[model samples]
Target: MKLFECQNCGQPLYFENTVCESCGHRLGYIPDMNTVSALEPEGDQWRALASSGQLYRFCQNAELDACNWLIPSDHTETHCAACRHNRTIPNLADAENMARYRKLEMAKHHLFYTMIKLKLPLKNRIDDPQGGLAFDFLSDQVDANGNVTTVLTGHDEGLITINVAEADDAEREKRRTQMGEPYRTLLGHFRHEIGHYFWDKIVRDCGEEALEKCRAVFGDEREDYGQALQRHYNTGAPPDWQNNFVSTYATAHPWEDFAETWAHYLHIVDTLETARSFGIKVRPRIKLGHELEAQVDFDPHKANNIDELIENWLPLTYAVNALNRSMGQPDFYPFILSPAVIAKLGYMHELTH
Candidate 1:
C-alpha cells in the first residue's frame, strides 16, 4: 500500500499501472525492489531503467493484462512471485469470467503488496510441500437454468478459494445486504481468507504456548465448527456481541473471531500506510481535543508498538470518514474499534511484528 512512482520519469503510478503516460515508458512492478520502474528493450530481455543492465521479463500473466510484475531474466519461473502462488484461474474463455478474474487479480496483487511490505514468508506450494500458500479463483457452479449453485469462498490447509463473482459490485452488494454485513469487498475476502492461512502457519505450527495464548484472546477452538456456524446462522449474534468481538460473525467461532480481527488489522495498517503516502496529517479546524490530530511521518509498517500504530490509524480513519460524509457518502469505515477489539488487534499486531 506504499506510494509508487515511475523511477525513470518521477511520474506517479497507481498500484495497477503498467505504463508511465508522462514518459511513454513501459512500466512494471518489481516485488523484490518494491518499486515500479521504467523498462528498456534489451536483445532478448528487457533491462529495467531503474537498475541498469539488469535484464527482466514481464510476468507471464502480462499476456492477460492480469499482472504488471517483472521477473529477472535468468529466473526459471515465468510468473512473478505473486502470480506463482495461484494454483488455478477462472475459465478465461467466458467473457464474464474473464472480467471477474481480472478484478480478482487486482485484489490479489494488492494483497501481495501488503504481505511483501510486512516481510511475511510467502512460500509457493512447490517450495513447502506441507505448509505453503496457493489460490484458486473459481466461478460458481451453475445449473441448466443459470442459477448459481455451490460456490464457496474459504481457506483449507493452505489454499485460499475465492468466488470470482465477488468482483461484480451488484452481486457483491446483494450478498452483503443479505448477510447484514457492514463491509465486504474482493480485497476484504482475500484478506479474511488469507488470515485463515496465516493462522495455520503462525498459530497452529508455532507451538502450544502460542496456540494457548490465541485461545485466551479469541476463545476455545475446541468447539464444533460446523455446528457452531449452523447455530450462529439460525440464531443471530447476541445483543452484546460487539462488546468483545470485532464483528457479529466473529461470534460464530474462535476461528472466525481470529480471522475477522486479522482482516481488520490488515485493513487498518494498509489503509493507514496509504494515508501516510499522501503526507496526510489530520488537525481538526475546531479547537477539538488532541485526539483529533495525527501526523504520519514515520513508516507505519515498522511501527514499533500497537499504540503507535493505532494513534496514526484512528485519526486517519476519522479523517477519511469525515471526507466521505462531506460528499454525502456513507462513513468510509463504518465499524467501531471498541476497546476489546483493540486488544484483539494488539494481539494480532504482536503476533505479526
Candidate 2:
C-alpha cells in the first residue's frame, strides 16, 4: 500500500483513514484514481478534492461503517468495487459478529488495494454468475441440540469462504498454534484463496498450453486433492519440505503450493511498497559487500523480475526482524526463501506479468 496525504492539510494519511487528522476533512477512497480524497458536501453527493470536479458517494456498506470506498455519483451501482463482491456477510445485528465483519472488511480492502495496483482482473458474481470473484463471510452453525458445525475457510471455483471467527485475534492465534503455522492472518487468507481463483482464470481456463506451463512450475495438480490433503495431515510434510515448499501446509497439494507461493509474492511486493512509501532504506554498518543493504527507490509492483524483489526483500526483512527482536517480539518474518522458492516466485511474477 502506498502512503497517502490529506489533500486538505497535506498531512500523512493511511489507506483506511475516514477523516483527516489535521484538517478534520472527511475522507473516502476513490478506486478509479487509487487515492483517498478529502470530501466536500454538495447537496446529497460529495466533491472529491483529490479528483476535482467529480461527485461521489460512499459505498452503501458505509451505512454500517464497514467500508470507506467511494463510487462515482453517476454510477448505477451503490456498492463500491470491493464490497460488491461480497456474496454473504455475517449477521451484523449481533455486536460480536458486526465487529468481526468489520475486521474482515479491513483486510479484504487491503487485498483489493494490492489487486487493483497490480491491474489484476476483477469481476463480481453479478458480472459473471457462473465464475466470478465473490466472498462469503460465514460463522460456524449450531443445531438445536448444541452440536456445532465448523466452517472451514477455503476457495471453491471463484467463491472464497472465510470463517468469521478468523477475524478474532485470540481465535486466530489459537488455530495458528494448533496448525503449527509460522504465519497466518486474514489478509494472508484472502491472498492465498484469491490465488486459487486466479489460477482458474490464468491457467485452468486459459488452455492446454497455459496449464502445461503452470504444471511445470507447481507440479501436476491432477493428483487427487482430497487424498493429498489426507496424506499430508496423516504424515505431515517431508523432513526437507522447506527446500521445496513455502509452508508445511503447501505440501498438501500442487494447488496449495501455488497458493502459498502466491501469497508470499503478494506479501513481498506490498510490504516493499510500504517501505518505499516511507523512504525506508537498509544499510547496515560493517555490511558484507552490500549483502544487507537495500534502497527501495522503485515500485515492486512493476519490478523487472522476482530477483529484483528478493534482493530488496531480504535486507528489509533482516532489519525488520532485528527490530522485532529488540522489542521482544517474534521475528517479523519467520520463513526462509530457498533457491527453489525463488524459482517458484519467478513463475508467479511471470504469470502476473
Candidate 3:
C-alpha cells in the first residue's frame, strides 16, 4: 500500500496499474523488491526501471489481463509468486466469469502485497501439497434441473474457495443485506479466509505451547465448531456481542473470532499504510485534544507492536469516517473494537512478530 510513482515519468501509480497514465509506460510489479516499475523492452524480457539490471516478464496470467506481478526472466516458474497458488479458476471462456476472475486476482494480489510486506510465510500447494496456500475461484453449483444450488465461500485447511459471484457489486451488496452484515467485499473475503490458512501455519503447526496461547486469546477452539456455527445461525449473536467480537459472525466460534480479528488487523495495517503513502495526517481542530491527532510517518507494517498500531489506527479511522460522512457515505469503520477485542488483536499481532 505504500505510495508508488512511475520510475520513468514520476506519475503517481496504483498497485495494479499495467501502464503508466502519464507517459504510457508499461508497468510490472517486482515481488522481491516489492515495487512496481515502468518496463523497457530488452529482447524477450523487459528491464524494470525501478529495479534495474534485472530482466523480467509479467506473470503468464498477465496475458489474460488477470495479473500484473513480475517474475525474474531466469526464474523457472511462469506464474508469479501470487498466481502460483491458484488451484482452480473460473471458466474464463465465459466473458462474465472472466471479468469476475480478474477482480478476484486484483484482490488476491493486494492480499499477497501485505503478506510479503509483513514477511509472513507463504508456502503454495505446489511446495507442500499436504498443507500449503491455494485458491479456488468457483462458479455457482447447479442441479440437474439447471437451478442454482449452493456455493459457500470458505477455507478448508490451506485452500481458500471464493464464490466468484462475490466479485459482482450488486450480488455482494444483496448478500450483505440478507446476512445483516455491516460490510462485505471481495478483498475482505480474501483477507478473512487467508486468516484461516495462516492459523494453520502459525498456530496449529507451531506445537502445543503456541496452540495453548492461541486458545487463551481466542478461547477454546476445541469446542464443537459445527454445533457452534449451527447455534450462531439459529440464534444470532448476543445483543452485547460487540463488547467482545468484531462482528456477529465472529461469535460463531473461536476460529471465526481469530479470522475476524485477523482481517481487521490486515485492514488497519493496509489502510494506515495507504494513509502514510499519501502523507495523510489527522489533527482535529477546536481543541478536541491530542488523542484525535495522528501522524503516520512510519511504516505501519513494521510497527513496534499492536498498541502502536491501534493508537494511530483510532485517530485515522475517526478522521476518515468523518470525511466519509461528509460525502454522504457509510462510515469507513462501522464495527467497534472494544477493550476485549483490542486484547485479541494484540494476540494476533504477536502471531506475526
Over the stretch 1-353, how does candidate 3's per-residue lDDT look in tens digits? 88899988899999999999899989999988988889999988899997758799889999999999999998899999999999999999999999999999999999999999889999999898999899999989788999996788999999899999999999999999999998998999999999998999999999999999999888899999999999999999999999999999999999999999999999999999999999988888857657688889889888888888888899998888888999999899998989999999888887887
Off by over 4 Å in 1: 144-148
Give the per-residue lDDT digits (tens) of candidate 1, residues 1-353. 87888877798888898879899888888888888888888786788877866789989999998999999998999899999999999999999988888899999999999999888889999898677999998877878998878679999999998988899999999999999998999999999999998898899889999899999999888899999999999999999998898899999999999999999989988988888888888887776748679988888778887788888888888889889999998788888788889999999999888
**For residues 1-353, could you state the per-residue lDDT of candidate 2 as single tens digits?**
89999988899999999999899999999998999889999999999999969899999999898899999999999899999999999999999999999999999999999999899989999999999999999999999999999999999989999999999999999999999998889999999999999999989999999999999988999999999999999999999999988899888999999999999999999999999999998999874847788999999999999999999999999999999999999899999999999999999998899
Ranking by TM-score: 2, 3, 1
Error of 1 at 159 (Å): 1.1
Error of 1 at 302 (Å): 0.9
In angstroms, how far off is 226's CA in candidate 1?
0.7
- lDDT of each model, Cα atoms only? 0.89, 0.95, 0.92
Clash list (residue pairs), candidate 1: none
TM-score on alpha carbons, each prediction = 0.97, 0.99, 0.98
Position 107, candidate 1: lDDT = 93
Q: Which candidate gets the maximum lDDT versus the true structure?
A: 2
